[model samples]
Target: MNLNQYIDHTKLGPTVSLAQIDQLIAEAIKYQFKSVCVSPVWVKYAKEKLASTNVLVCTVVGFPHGTSTTKVKIYETKEAVKDGADEIDMVVHVADVKAQNKKAISKEIKGIVKAAAGRTVKVIIETAYLEKKEITSVSKLAIKAGAHFVKTSTGYAPSGANVTDVKLMKKVVGDAGEIKASGGIRSMEDAKAMIEAGATRLGTSSGVSLMEGEKINGNTTY
Candidate 1:
């Protein structure tokens, strides 16, 4: 399947520069992917850069690490939305979940969802750190907490968006919500597979390169 529409052309890193965000916006405008995902710090600039275009602006809350306090994540979500972020992707507290502190994780995600104030909220589950049952429980909790999507990873983890995790999230959320597959999805094949496995959204920095390679080379295996 053609997976371009499922992409959120992403660029989130510790050292991502303003010039890089501009370039990301430029590439998003050129490619017209679903959106451009950036860090919360760059939301304002990313919003300004994307203002003229129809491309949506997305920024993360709780970020790569989900260790932030619930209040902090909520505050980050509020500030990100105020800065013009069209969508909020917040990381679910993996530690809380792993410790069986479901209440804390639920509260954190719910805070972010409410902070969104009706905007789209995607909860990152960081699947690499969770088992199958944990994945199911988190998906259910996120859905119950009013999240619009369940995301697979932070990309900073040891692994990202495996087909197994995608399928698991898909099974749990089903038609009630959406699933976003991210991290380590660098090729057209992986992107397509994620979509097939029920990922409605894809987050990756390799979007432009993926398309370029597809153009320069046919569907033959790389």
Candidate 2:
């Protein structure tokens, strides 16, 4: 498959600068990646910079951690969509899954998805912190909650997306929603492996190097 089409060129570090956002937009446009994912604060700027292009502007809500209240996540989703984010990757509360609180999980996911209006909502289940059964369970809940996609990780976890996780997520989702494999995907081989395991999208801070068919080097902040 054409990998670029599935790549969501991302930079979600806490210390990202406007200059870096400019560089990210430039690289995204140059490489023709599907989208440029950033924090909510940069969504408008990224949207403006890429207004004349087909590249999408994506932003995160309740990022890195999914412990935010449902109300906060809903508000974040609305604000992100208002700020010109074409897609919202909202993290789901990991505690809900660990506690087996399916009702709360469903309620939270629904609230965020509803607040997104018509914008695409990708529910980040933070697979690294979940067991295999939790992965399948949450994937089903995401689909039932009206999420457009079920994402694998936040890239801030101890581990990120793996082929086995992707396969399990896809099996659970089963065309009900798309799967985005993210976090720690830093090479062409890793990207391909995720896609081969049924990832419709790949999120990485190493998009530039991966697109260039190289492994990321140095202490990158993504």
Candidate 3:
């Protein structure tokens, strides 16, 4: 497997610096990663840096916590797209999922999808905070709302992606949407397991290490 193609070479820490983003872009160019997932603030810079390459520029909306109002999330998506983001990874409101407010969840997702204006939008359900049934339900909502992918985590949660969650999401998404397994995936073994479970994309800060076959010990915030 060409693992690099599946990776969205990621770095989304709150305190990330310009130098770190430059390094991230350089590494992405070197490894030919599918994209570089950065914070919204760096979308323009990353896009400019990656203009000549096939690597896309991805950004997050509603982020680690999915409490932002739908209007705010839509504005974030528009601004990120204006700054040249090629893909958007958005967090869904877990409260709505818990409340079983399918209408609200669908509205929020559809709004963001419309704001994205045809760019790929991956909805992050932050599986760490949800029940299995909730995951399945929300993944269906995302697909119904026209999201291109249903993502596992934001990497800021207590835990991240797991094989079981990926498989469950895959079953729900089927061919209507794709799966992006993010967070806690630290090694080649972990990446392969996610893929086998039906993840077409991976959001990780350990892409280079995984490619080098080196497993580093620490928490990865992707």
Question: Which of the numbered candidates is closest to the native, going by highest lDDT?
Answer: 3
lDDT of 2 at 51: 94
Candidate 3, residue 164: lDDT: 95
Ranking by TM-score: 3, 2, 1
Off by over 4 Å in 2: 218-222
Which sequence of candidate numbers ranks them by lDDT, best first? 3, 2, 1
Segments of candidate 1 deviating more than 4 angstroms: 214-222
lDDT for each candidate structure: 0.85, 0.88, 0.94
Best by TM-score: 3
TM-score of 2: 0.96
Off by over 4 Å in 3: none
For lDDT, candidate 2 versus 3, the one ahead is 3
RMSD of each: 3.5, 1.3, 0.7
Clashing residue pairs for model 1:
none
Candidate 2 lDDT, tens digit per residue, 125-157?
A: 988889999999999999998999999888787
Model 1, 45-76: lDDT tens per residue? 88888888888999988887888888888999
Error of 1 at 73 (Å): 0.5
